[model samples]
Target: MFTLSSEDNTNFTELLKAVHKIGSKTIAKHAQDVDQKARFPVESFAAIKSLNLMSAYVPVKLGGMGLNVEQISKICEVLALYCGSTAMIYSMHKIQVACIVHHCMQVDYFKNYVKKLVSEQRLIASATTEIGTGGDLLSSFCAVKESDGQFTLTKKAPVISYGEAADDLMLTARRNIDAPNSDQVGILLTKEQFQLEPISGWDTLGFRGTCSSGFIVTASASIAQVNPVPFSEILSQTMHPFAHITWASLWSGICTDAIDNARKFVKNSVRRNPDMPPISSIRLAEVTGSLNNMRNNISASIKEYTEMLIIGDSDAFTNFGFSTRINNLKISSSQMLIDIVGKAMMICGISSYRNDSELSLCRHIRDAYGASLMVNNDRILMHNATLVVMHKEAR
Candidate 1:
């Protein structure tokens, strides 16, 4: 049964232990370097793969441990506490696996691939978001054309996490040739067949290590075979909630880390001066409390959202409600993290601002701010939520 509480639960305990072993020190040491150079965290991915963490979402039927969303969320939180970019990349791969499992009825090749991923410890990454389409992931500027029972695609993905290094890419593209607003989207995988066309446009302020560079794909390359049914499902349902929960979990971890650093700094200051400012101490406590509150709220939201998804009502309105809640949580968590980090910076003074601190409160503040802006912007999401409510009320 592979119970989490059981001492002999090798998969559960080992997964946690592997995350700590692979992520803790290496992420702390290289996070700044990766951010500064805007390089992908290759070593972190290597470590994660070594622990078979990348295959966590592959179902038990497919020979994977098949952990649930809550378990995966915990693992993500642990990793994000060390490095946000690494966590984001890793989460995306997991989402890819979940998408594959949920959508396909024929499991022969999919199960084989899952077993191979676990045995070989290979990583898969999503190559979805594009430059021209903005955040409308459903409509990709990329398109797939079929000839002689084979498919080829021409794509220009703007931000593919682990784009340069992944073993395989699960990409989305429009299939219809004539219709501009085609609902027939195809999800395809490309092995080592494609080349990374030179992309000179990857300078970002935060989560720099994401290596979120753009690439152009030509039709000459052979597209790896993919099952479109699961792929499309991934785009609509699995990807969105997975993204929300993963990012929210990361933000929660970062918030906790910031609170811990702030507490340590305050304690040190008080030790140095028998009478540190009373207001400083009070503010630290308040920030800590606020962070805790945000964590609880996000955790609860994730639980509720997951339950809704598992209940499996395919009503369009129900899906919107789930997505709206997820979006709100992301916004709320980002704000809380910003507040905590900003206060910590004030408390820790110029030292926290310096690049040498293991905590890197300044970098986190910037990263958190950027995350809040990406995909569905917090302000826009709030507006959408209001409209949804209004539409429901009128009905």
Candidate 2:
């Protein structure tokens, strides 16, 4: 589905196999507890870190495996099947890495930081949301107050996913004290560079292991710590596409697991009756069709996006058509996951509702619902509508 040379395919397959092994042996075991406790998935993430998969998004020349988005994506999908929380945390981490790799290469400071990440297998978190911005991630209420080649920032972040677990975060703020609220910059900070006093809880319906708590973030770094590119540019060129696709891939994994369970239940029922396929088989086929549609939609977007990236389409990031398409893929994937998982729940009946049932989908059903609300689908739709009104056709 994703284009890769023959040798690349072979290596990708082996890497995926290794990730699946960790998922099955480690992540799957801790999945339920992680959900039940609403705490960090220490065991699962530890195993992944041990495998040195944390740096897969870093270039091989910089000490990583040099895998592209598709390879990291497949690995994310595999992890999701075992534990949604682990998968989400992993996906967000890679998104931060993608932004850095794509936009920060020209800066020696960030270049060295990338190599440091690969060497230490460091975990990176994101701090994009602000309390005063009302969830307007593009606007910042704080700015880098600089002095003598040094800078300090005091940001009230409304949500910092996996903040306690990560060693570093790419924090977004205004470019300078005099800059407009919409003028943004990203800075790299480690534990030493920042003080995070967690001020929120993480209890939620799905992806609980992410541990997304609010924090009063205070940090300072050298002037060199700032990436020269604007935050909006980085979002349009790298962060947006990487985040949506990787997140969709993980959601697809949740859908795949639910469908497989439904298949098992329906097949077993038919075997027991031995008269004909159960009436539920119809619904099974219907949901399976939706699942296939969802997967293909995601895959095609990845392929098209990758092609544009490879061809160096200068306007690819800002093209209204491409942006609308990306938004649609996110909307479709989010909606389909809920539809597919809901049908799977109905097919299995009482058993699937029980936590002890082998076909239990309570976790999956809960996790699937996170899709639409995570980034607020209505916000995305409204943004696309405005773009549609202004987009000129290629006449």
Candidate 3:
């Protein structure tokens, strides 16, 4: 499904096998507790960090695995089957790595930082969504202030997924005080360089393990910490596609687990009464079909996006049609997860609803809801609507 050298393909296969082992042995054991406590999946991440998977997306030349987005998406899918929060945190970290690898690594400072990240197995967090921005990612309320080759940025973000646990933060802000809010630059700041003031708690409906709370972030860094490429280019070329694809992959994993549980419930019922098939057997079939459709949608997008990235189609990435298509993929995928989970719940009946039942889907359903609200599906639709009105047909 993806192009890779023989050695990399072998390595990718081995890495995937390792992730599956970790998911079942470590992540699955802690999933329920993580959800109940609304805390970070420390044990699952300890297992992940032990394997140094944090740098899985980085290039082999940079002393890392050099896995592509598709490969990484598969890893997220695997992790999510055991624990959605662990999968989400892993995917978000890789998204930041993708942005830097694609856009900022050309600069010596970021290049060295990538190597450092690989060596240290450092976790990176994102701070793109800010307060008073109405969840608008392109604009920033904070600006980077520079002085004598040093710079400081103060940003109040509504949520920084797993921020407290991260070793570094990949943040976005206005280029300077005089620049427009949309003229933003991406910056990398280590824990030593930034101070975080917790403004809100992380008690949420789903994705509780993410620890995504509001924070007032004040960061100081060398001017060299800023990426040379503009945030808009980075957003279009790497961040948008990487984030949507990985996120969709993880959601599919969560839904797949729920379906599996529902299937198990049906099988158990059939064993008890061989005379007639359980009514939910039909629902299991229906949801399975929907699951396939959801997976195929995600696979097709991964293939298309991977091909464009391989060929370095920067213009295509930024095009209105491409952006709309990616945004729609997110919207559809998010809705499909909710639909799949709801159906699975219906199939398992009270068993799925009861938190004590082994076939329970309460956790999966809650996590599925996070899909639509994370970025808000309506916001994407409205943005695409504007793009559609402005997009011109190619002759």
Error of 2 at 171 (Å): 0.7
For candidate 2, write residues 1-395 as lDDT tens digits. Answer: 11222123457777788888889999999999999998889998888888778888776667777787777788888899999999999999999988888788888998999888887888999999999787777899899999999999999987899899889988999999999999999899888899998888888898888899999999988989998688887887778888889999999899889988999999999999979889889989999999889878878888877776677655667788888888888888999989999999899998889999999999999888888998889999998889989886568
| Candidate with best TM-score | 3
Ranking by lDDT: 3, 2, 1
Q: TM-scores across all candidates?
A: 0.87, 0.96, 0.96
Q: Candidate 1: deviation at residue 368, Å?
A: 1.8
lDDT, model 2, position 86:
96
Model 3 has an lDDT value of: 0.90
Question: lDDT of each prediction vs. the true structure?
Answer: 0.69, 0.86, 0.90
Q: Please give the clash total of every predicted structure, in order.
A: 0, 0, 0
1 or 2: which has the higher lDDT? 2
Instruction: Assess candidate 2 and give its TM-score to the true structure.
Output: 0.96
Instruction: Highest lDDT: give the candidate number.
Output: 3
- Tens digits of per-residue lDDT, candidate 1, 1-395, equal 01112112346876787787777767766777888888988778778776777777666666666777777888888888888888877777787777766654354556566677888877776777666875676676656676666667767777676677778777776653553533445453545556667454668878777777778755433333545453345554677777777787887777777777877887777888876564578888888888778878767876775665566654431355555666667777777777778887787777778777754587778777767666747564755667577444223
